[model samples]
Target chain A: MKKKLNLRKATPWLSAIGLFVLWELVVRIFNIPPYVLPTPSESIIVGWQFHEAIWMHAYHTLYTTLAGFAIAVVFGVVLGALVGSSRAIYDAANPLLVGFNSVPKVALVPVLVMWFGIGTVPAIITAFLISFFPIVVNVATGLATLEPELRDVLRSLGATRRDILIKVGFPRAMPYFFASLKVAITLAFVGSVISETVASNVGVGYLMLSASSKFNMPLVFAGLLVIAVMGIAMYEIFNVIERRSTKWANRGNPTN
Target chain B: MSNSFVELNDVKLRYSEGDDLALETTNMKIDKGEFIAVVGPSGCGKSSLLKLVSGLMPPSEGSVIVDGKEVAGPLKIVGMAFQNPTLLPWRTTLDNVLLPMEIVKPHRHRLRKYRAEYEERARKLLATVGLEGHEDKYPWELSGGMQQRASLCRSLIHEPELLMLDEPFGALDAFTREELWDILQNLWMIKPFTVILVTHDLREAAYLADTIYVMSKRPGKILVERENTLVRPRDQETTFTQPFTDLVHELRSHIRDVRES
Candidate 1:
């Protein structure tokens, strides 16, 4: 049993390494020019060689995503609570929210650039906008879909509406809230990078764009690797946080 | 003007105006600390009756009074359980049980200061329901029977004057259901809180209640009100007795009549 557990734990790392090795074999076998498609080894070697630049860009991207995500969390929860709790607010805002979410966030980058002028502000704002929707939608869904039986349990206690929301609704929404955080954090990275590529000079997105313009495919791949790693690191952090805080929600899933 | 603990007078309930009535005009008089079971066919609005009595829903036409006051909203002196148990999944068995103390006033205010005192009370209730050590486990971690037991503890923890149950044992298997019946009976025998238990199970009604109310199908109103004189502290053997069989048979026939009609 312990051996099986160890194998299960090792699968992700094994799969990742296997993919890199396959990429190397495919590149060598196909004799693909690095300018068109670089081997994983070349990407990693190039990435390490420019570690200082890559580290700076990665750090900036990480902090920007975190900042936007922080804002999104606060507003998303508040707006979600409002929209979820009352029929009137939901009816009034739902169409607008739906319309807003439907418009691809990438389309908004130019408008953000126009308003905020090509820099950190535009990147941060874009990150906030792109990531905000899921957090709000999930939080609202969590509160809105509270089982009627559960509501009756609280309502039957003579609990006020506020009391019900605070005591029951929010706690019930924790799993959904965390689920949104994971998605939103990843999207926040996308948002930040989109803004960086279009409007800013700093961050991994900008570095990749710079490398690509110079036809430095290996360097571009290196920057891509940096962004992917950051996204995965953030995702893992939220995953751990979720597993610790909402174990009850994961019932019937194999123990993580 | 009667001094019944819970009285529903000419009560009618509709989800909306000009809609089909969920409950027709129904009247009931329950004495303080009396245990009553409501039994009927499916869709008989037995649950609607409990909701009215507990003030979770108001009757459309007539006044419903409890403890000398007309119920304008949900009553504080009521503890409720449903077929689903409805224990918060996020909460530990004990925390779920103490949910009322976090809401019902005086207790909510004093919860921080007297949390330990309240915990002891909650612990005793859990112990009474055979959930003493399982208190710290999350509700989802427990079996269906154990979760339901914790729900029962939660309902009674606040020592409400009226305990409203809507098929509280309906989801359990037969053996677990029977075990819970005995546990519930023992607890009631000790404290004797007024109970309004709604169930489709005639044997359960006969075993646990002083009075059994049978209701008709939708737009439900009481069809029969039978008083039980069964021996006290009813057990498994009592269920096999001739009188018990007779009572269940009688209730079954009434239910069959309603279902047929």
Candidate 2:
């Protein structure tokens, strides 16, 4: 088991190192044009030169992503719990939720910008739109699929509805909630960047847009690298939280 | 008999708006501190009877009186365990057992002040079920039988006046099932709470119950009730004896009638 876990933990970093080495070797061997794909070293140099400026933009996108992600989690969980507990309510509202999900989240960016303007509000709203559905859908499924016998057991013990919700329903939904968080975190960053690209004066998305227009491929590559790093960092943080919250997975049984 | 602890008079139950009744005019009176087993065919309303007794549902056409009061809703003194043993995965075995104390009223009001006492009680209960060393372990860490044992401890931790077991050992292997039977027998022998066990296992019914009630299918009704003259603290050795097999075979023949009819 220890060996299995070590392999699982080591594989990602090993693959990443291998990919970087291959990229560097290919670039040096073929003398590929930097415009097509900047060599890893060239991109790193560019990334380091404007590190402070890149961080300022990175922080803006990060803040917006966080604010939107937090709002979506809170609202989605509460709403999901309500919808999940009642089949009638779920059937009534499912079409509306699905329809909202179908409409391109980017299309909402203009309307959000028009309403909230070109500040953090519009960007945060965009992130919320993109990240909210997964949480709501996953949590609703988790809440709905609780075993009937389990509910009967609680009922026989005279557990109140609130008691079941807090003690059984919410904790039962944690695995689903964490799975959704993995998807939501990446989408949140993407949504923030997209919003910034369309309607912002600051953020990594704006930096990428400006660099591309000026044909500064190296700077564009730098912005892309920063976005990648941020997404990975956020994913790692959430993965840690998921591991701690769900050590029950270690025993390979989810009886509850 | 007149001072029955639980009484159900002509109880009729149905599942849906227009379906036939699940239980039909079933009458029963249980004395306080008596242990009863209910056995029946598949799709019979044995479970429905338990539901009525626990006040999870009201009988369609009868009155259920527990301790001389009409059961308007769920009673706080009822504790239940089932075959699958659903303990919350997030909590330790000890926490899961103490869950009722966290919610049930008098205990709920005093839980914070009485945390240490509750823990001790939970520990003692787990120890009774042979789960003492596993207090800190989560439900997933334990095997199926171990988890069920922990679930039993959880059900009894609140010291409820009535204990309900809904096929609690149905999922276990024969050896484990018999082991739990002895454990359960010892627990009841010590406390003497009123017990209502719903099961398909005739031997289990014969081994554990003071009285066994048989029910018919669909719109289920009690067909017969037999008093077991078996002595207390029955061991595995007793199950091999003539009286035990005779009692089990009798219950089995009644279930055959229930199935065919």
Candidate 3:
């Protein structure tokens, strides 16, 4: 079992390395210009040379994304509870929220920039706007779909609505909340990057945009790599938290 | 006037205005500490009766009087268990059992002050249902039968005057169901409480109840009330007896008649 597990874990890295080698061979054989599509080795060299700059930019993206994600968590939970608790609030707000969610978040960046000015503020706002919807939807679904039998049990015990929500609904939503966090974290990064590319002077997104305009293809690829790594790291952190917090939800599933 | 512990006077329940009645003009008078079982076909509102008595829902037209007072809302004196164990998956067996105590009061207010005492009671209840060592185990770790047993402990934890069970053993296997029957009976024997059990199983009704009320198909009304004459301290041996079989047969026929009509 241990050997199999180790082999399973190694598979992805092996495929990734193989893909990079193939890309390098294709670039070298085609005699591709470094400005058009840099070889994997060239990209690595460029990334190493610009490590300090990349780290600084990555830090800005990370903090802005986190700031937005933190706001999303608080606002999502509150709005989710409100929507889930009452049919009136759900009916009233649902269509408006749907319409808002339908609008391309990229279009909203210019408007956000106009209102908040440039730099991290618009990026953070964009991140908060884009990532919060999934959390709200998942949390609301969790509370709304609470087992009727369980509700009846609590109701028969003379538990008030507040009592029921606090005791059962909130805990029931924890799994959904955690699940959404993993998805939302990725989206938060997308939001921050989009805003950064359009309006920001710093961050990995800005680094990529500036590099590409100057035909620094290798540096642009390096920026992409940094964003992907940060996104993966955040997602993994939430996944770990989710597993610990909602272990019971995953009990019957063999994958856990 | 008979001092009935729970009285349903011309009780009728309809989901909405002009909707078909779920229960129609049902009248029942349960004596204090009596174990009553209600059996009927699917969608016959056997559950509605339990809900009315437990004050989860008020009768549309008529009154549900428990302990000589009309029930206007959910009663704190009642504890309930359903077909699904409905134990919170996140909670341990002990914590699930203590859930009611944390909600219903004067116990709720006293929970913090008498935390140890409440926990002790919860532990004892778990032990009664053979869940002593499993107190700290989450619900999903336990089997279906074990979860149901813990559910029973939860219902009784608050020491409510009334217990409402809606097909509480319907999902368990035959052996597990029979085991729960004995456990439930022993609990009632030790501390008598008014029990209103709604089930489809005729044998279960005969084995556990003092009186079995058979209800008609949808828009349910009581079609028959058969008093169980089996000797006291009923057990697995009693279930095998001729009298027990006869009682079950009689209840089955009444259900059949209700179904046909």
Q: Looking at the true structure's interface, with contacts defined as alpha carbon pairs within 8 Å between chains A and B, what fraction does model 1 recover? A: 0.83
Model 2 chain A: weakest 10-residue lDDT segment is: A247-256
Instruction: Put the candidates in DockQ order, highest first.
Output: 3, 1, 2
Better of 1 and 3 by lDDT: 3
* Deviation of model 2 at B88, angstroms: 1.9
lDDT of 1 by residue, A158-207 (tens): 88999989988898889999999999999999999998998899998899
Total backbone clashes of model 3?
A: 0
Who is ahead in lDDT, 1 or 2?
1
DockQ of 1: 0.72
Assess the local accuracy of residue B106 in candidate 2 as a C-alpha lDDT between 0 and 100.
Answer: 85
What residue runs in model 1 are displaced by over 4 Å at the alpha carbon? none
Q: Candidate 3: where are CA atoms >4 Å away?
A: A252-256
User: What docking class should model 2 receive?
Assistant: medium
lDDT of 3 at B128: 82
Off by over 4 Å in 2: A1-10, A20-41, A252-256
- List model 2 lDDT by residue over A1-256, tens digit each: 7797788789999998898889989988998888877788788898789889899999998999999999899988987998888899899989999999999888988999889889788899999889999999989998998888777767766788888888888888988999899899899998899999999999999989988898777889889888998899999898878878877754554321
| Model 1 chain A: ten consecutive residues of lowest lDDT | A149-158
